[model samples]
Target: MSDAVQTLTIVIPLQVKPRGGRKAMVRPGVLALERRQDVTLIKAVARAFRWRRMLESGRFATINELAAAEKINASYVSRVLRLTLLAPDIVEAILDGRQAPGLDLPRLLAGFPLAWEKQRASLSPA
Candidate 1:
C-alpha cells in the first residue's frame, strides 16, 4: 500500500447545564462515575449540623445568638438550622451527591414538610 496521510474525526453529544452557579457538561444517556457533589449544598448542610451541635452543647442560647456569633442574619441561620429536620436518607443523598438533580439550597431553604414521609414525597423528582 502507498503511504498516505490519514485523518480521524470524533464526535460526542453533550449538554451544558448550570449546577450551583457552575456549568456542567452532561453527556446524553450516560451515567457519570464521579459524584456530582454540590459544594454550596454540602456547606449549608454542614453548617446547619454544626449550629445544631452548638445549641445542643449549650454554647448558643438561641438562633439569634448563633447568628450573632456567625455574623449572619438570624432568619438565615434559622432556615439553615431547619436542615437538621431533614430525613436521614435525604441527608445521606445530599452528602453522597445522590440528591435529585433539581434539588438546591434555595428550594431546601424555602421549607419542607416536617413529616419525614412528606419530605421524601415533596423533595422527590416530580
Candidate 2:
C-alpha cells in the first residue's frame, strides 16, 4: 500500500415513487347523466326518421296530395311540418333520407304497423 491515502467517492441513486391514479373515477351520478343524455338522443333520432319519410314520399307536392297519401287532413300535414323546426341535422336527414343498417326505416315503420293496419281495415268497410 502507498503511504499517501486514496480518496473514494460513492454515489447513491435517488428512487422516485410513481404518481398514483391521477384521473378521477367515474361516479354513478355521472353514469346516470350519460344514460339520460343517450335516451334523449335516441328519441330525437326516431323523430328525424319519421320526418324524413314524410318529405321523401312526394306527398309534400301539395296539401291535397299529402292529405291523400297520409290519409290525414291537409291541415294536419301542415301542423306536422312544424317538426322541421328541430335541429338542422335532423331536418337534413329527413329531406335527404337514406336507409342504413342502424337507421332501419322498416323497423321503425313496423313498430306501428298494427295502428296503420287498423286504420286501413276501418277504411275498407265490408
Best-fitting candidate, scored by TM-score: 1
Report the Cα lDDT for candidate 2. Answer: 0.44
lDDT of the structure predicted as candidate 1: 0.87
All candidates' lDDT scores? Answer: 0.87, 0.44
Where is model 1 more than 4 Å wrong at Cα? 1-35
Q: Worst lDDT window (10 residues) for model 1?
A: 28-37
TM-score of 2: 0.28
Worst 10 residues of 2 by lDDT: 98-107
> What TM-score should be assigned to candidate 1?
0.72
Candidate 1 structure quality by residue, lDDT tens digits, 1-126:
979989899998887867569988888653352356667999999999999999999999999999999999999999999999999999988887778888999999999999999999988545
Instruction: Return the clash pairs for model 1, or none.
Output: none
Candidate with the greatest lDDT versus the true structure:
1
**How much is the lDDT of residue 48 in candidate 1?**
95
